[model samples]
Target: MQIAITGTGCYIPSITIPNDDFAANNFLNSDGTPIQHENRLVIEKFKAITGIGERRYVEPHLNTSDIALLAAEKALTDANIDKEELDYIILAHNFGDVSSGQSQSDTIPSLASRVKHLLRIHNPKCIAYDLLFGCPGWVEGVIQACAFIKSGMATKCLVIGAETLSRVTDPHDRDSMIYSDGAGAAVIEAVENGGKILSHATRTFTYEEAYFLFYGTSYRPTAKNTKYIKMYGRKIYEFAITNVPKAMKECLNESGAGIEDVKKIFIHQANEKMDEAIVSRFYGLYDRSMPKDVMPMNIHKMGNSSVATIPTLFDMVRKGNLKNQSIEKEDVVIFASVGAGMNINAVIYKV
Candidate 1:
């Protein structure tokens, strides 16, 4: 029996917010001081480093669980499986369902439970739960599902990564432009013939790295006690470049696949420059130059949706929606991510 992802789907929000749209934002320094650079200059520098020109936001009426349900339905249709057959439903995210115009997150029922309810699956045997592992949550959920399958505890599982970062963003924070809203889901099962998961590795660093990303007050002093997603951009970049590549290399080596066999890599869409640096260092370990088109990035348009980025990009590429990026049978690929917990994880798969 081979563990595999049978179907995948994603929800890309309709509302687009361009970089120019942020020009009017009253941007402020973390210390509540005025920025010397103009909004245009700041945006240009941001675009150059992160490659994000725009991002999507959910409709006023929609929430994280709502989009999750949409993606789950599409995944079920693509898998052609009975929802009741699923033995587990795992939802990965940071903030829960933050309704539009609200600052607080709602996670009482758990996003996984909410998705299961929305799917109308009444199977009590189908365990539903939420996982908060920073942006690597989805990848970690997939690994957990594989563990269940391997240990004879489950036959099938549904793993989803969803987030509505727009609701928790601070208008005064420039880093807010890097956050967006999206959801992605995949059906995992043991198959007689299909793509297979080879190996995976995960790590969490709390030694002075735990707060690389966190919730903090707005840059504006008068914004009160309201919290928003904030990060030490330079610190996170340094942490990721130093640690992510090592985890990826370890995962690839454990998979027993040669470096030359890798055809594609789906990494978290945090920053374009940081991603490029990580991949470059990874290949350098094998004494080879990074190959062209080995990585397909959607950050230019999607920004960073935290846990949702990798699986969403995977769905897009699988459906042939990403130009010049596709996978084939027996192809070796890697999925990797880094985020708030200072967490890092990587998975090697054969398609």
Candidate 2:
């Protein structure tokens, strides 16, 4: 029983925050103290370093569930399936929708449930849940959907990764420049002779680096920068270059595929340079030169939308929205992401 991806969709906000916006604002620390660095040069250096030019921010009234609903509708329409036909809705997001002026998120009802309601899906048998796996949340959702379908527990599943990161991101934190808001979704169904989902692997480093990046509900004036996302960027960069390739290799080995067979690698659009380096290193392990168009990127426009990155990139390429990045039937593809929780995962897919 192979899991087949029937359709895909994405919803990016209209508001594009250019790098200059960060330069124009005077940033403050979590304690309300002014930040030391704020300049056009800083933005320039950021772009040179991360390959991000501008990013998306949701409209004033939209929430995580709102964009997710839009993406789901597009995915369902693409799949040519009714909303009621979905057997499961697996949504991924680190922070729930943050209401205006709120410093934190509230996930009491779960974003997936909210989307289910918005879609008017009344099938009690259809499970709706949220999965938190840092930036790999969307990919994890797909892997779980495949498991459910393979086990006869589900016939069709809707997987979504949506986030309004701008709401929770601290205006003072430099990381705010890199975080954005968006949603991406895919419809996966069990089909005879589909054999679409090839293989996947996951790993978590929770003992020492578990809290490397975290988001909390309230602002603490005295605590160690716990209000917004705080991370050791240098350490994360090292971890991605070191560990991601190994995970990807294992996924490929399990799929019985070689690096040369991969048509495109849809990586989490966190840092353009880091993603390129990771893929480069992964192919290096095989002692084979990487193909020129093996990696497709949108970090320049989308930044790190966490869970939304991979799915949105895939949809963009699949629809020919991205220049020089496209896929064809039976084309081999790979997906990988690493983020908070120090978690990493990789998947092999076929078009």
Candidate 3:
């Protein structure tokens, strides 16, 4: 039996926040000093580097779990499977359920468990849990599902990647503009015929890169004791370009596929420039120029929604929703991501 992703879905938040929406924000330096440049210049520079002009935000009443359940339901319907038949629910997220206007993250009941409950699956045998592997969480969840299927621990699984980065961002920090909120999900199962997983690779570089992305106090000194999602932008870009390509090359090589066979690459939507650099360097590994349109990007409009990027992009492309992008049967694709925990991972898949 081939382990494959049979169905996919995503929930893009309804609220569209354009870059100009942040024009009034009091941007600050890491040391709490105000940025000398006007907000327009700042936002323009951010857009130039990250390719983000707009992003989506959940409505005031929604939380991470709510959107996750929304995506999960769609995935189930797309997969055309009874909820009771699911053997696992794996939800990958970073800051869990940060309520509107709140700083605390609520994970009392794991997001996966909450999604299962919301899905109303009564089967007690369906194991549910949350995974925190930074932005690569969703891709890693797929890897975990393949493991369970191979080990006879599961047959049908729902893997989800959701995040409310908007809720956890610091208004004073410039990096806040790089974040948004969204969720995506997929149904993974043992199939008689369809897409199949070919190979995967994962790595953690904690010795020195552990703190590249972390939770830290606000850039404004007056903000008391509350921490928000933070990162060293330059550090992450350098880390990604230097390492992410190597991992993708490693995974692709392990799949025994030639470089020309890869149709598309679904890389993490962290930054437009960083992603382009990574892919360029990836092709450089084979001493060939990067193919035209080998990578599809939505970060220009969607911003960085963390773990939600890859799966959501996949769902959109597979359904012919992303303009000029689509996947067909027997096509080879690569999924990769890098984020907090200083973690990186890549998967080789065939549709």
Candidate 4:
């Protein structure tokens, strides 16, 4: 069985916070020069390291659901399908409506019912649920969607990776600069031909190692204190450099595709350095002849949207920026991500 992403869409918050405003708000140098104060220096260092120039944050009144709804609507419309045609709605979110109480307590069915009412999707067979993983959520969700269709459980699925990281960011912390609010959606349909999810591979290194990057009730107590997403930068960098390439190789081996067969690689836009490291590793393995192109690191423009990264790239590709450098219909595109769980996943697609 095969699944193709027939529709793709994304929603970025309306508020655009420029780098200068960010620097000023945090009381730091605009060019990220080292400030005298240790805290200020850390903030500037974050800006310098992540290369994030601007980011969008939803208004305090808005939530992930609102952003997700917008993207989901666009995706459904793009696929020329109504909400009523959807068999399942799987939301991949690290953050949800705070007004709905605790994160996990806010059931997907309840949220989906509200969304259904708002969108008038009166399909009784539609089952909605939430799946929370780190950045690998979208890849995993797509894999699961294919399984559901293969099992005859659902014919059509709306897999959405939506995040309002702004809600979890520690405003006082410099790390917050690399987080933004956004959502992306894809309509996965079981199809025989055209852009099928050919194969996927995933691995977990250590749950303890994964705990280094996280956000939740256990991590923070109050909303006012949740303005930054913290990370052990050096540790994450080391992990990505070591694991991403290995994961990609394993995926290619499992899919029966050599590294040379891939035309483009869409990696999680976590950091610029991470991208360079992965590409370097890919070249080292393949004699430096198989050049792999990656999506323009949007971290400078949109920060890290966590799970939303891949699907956002999918939307961008559909919009005309992400494409094979060589340009061939059968050229392979490899999607990979290494997230907080210390987990890595890769999927191959024939464009």
**Tens-digit lDDT string for candidate 1 (1-351):** 999999999999999999999999999998999899999999999999999999999999999999989988988899999999999999999999888888888999999999999899989999999999999999999999999999999989999999999999999999999999999999999999999999999999998999989999999998879899999999999999999999999999999999999999999999999999999999998999999999989999998999899999999998999999998889999999999888999999998
Flag the better candidate by lDDT, 1 or 2: 1
lDDT of 2 by residue, 1-351 (tens): 668899899998999998988876655555557656656766777799889999999988888999999999999999999888889999999888887667667897999999999999889988999998899999999999988988888999999999888887765566678899899999999877654899999999988888777764223344354366666777899999999999999999999877778999999999888898999999999997778988998889888898999999999999999989889988889999999989999889987
List model 3 lDDT by residue over 1-351, tens digit each. Answer: 999999999999999999999999999999989899999999999999999999999999999999999999999999999999999999999999999988899999999999999989999999999999999999999999999999999999999999999998999999999999999999999999998999999999999999999999999998889999999999999999999999999999999888999999999999999999999999999999999888999898898999999999999999999999988999999999999989999999999
C-alpha lDDT values of all predictions: 0.95, 0.87, 0.95, 0.73
RMSD of 1: 0.6
| All-Cα superposition RMSD per candidate | 0.6, 2.3, 0.6, 4.5
Q: Cα lDDT of model 4 overall?
A: 0.73
The sequence of per-residue lDDT tens digits that candidate 4 reaches over residues 26-134 is: 4323233434675545555666777777888777776777777888898998888877878988888765554422233344554445555566777788887777768
| Model 2 clash tally, residue pairs | 0
Q: Give candidate 4's error at residue 287 in angstroms.
A: 3.2
Candidate that scores best on lDDT? 3
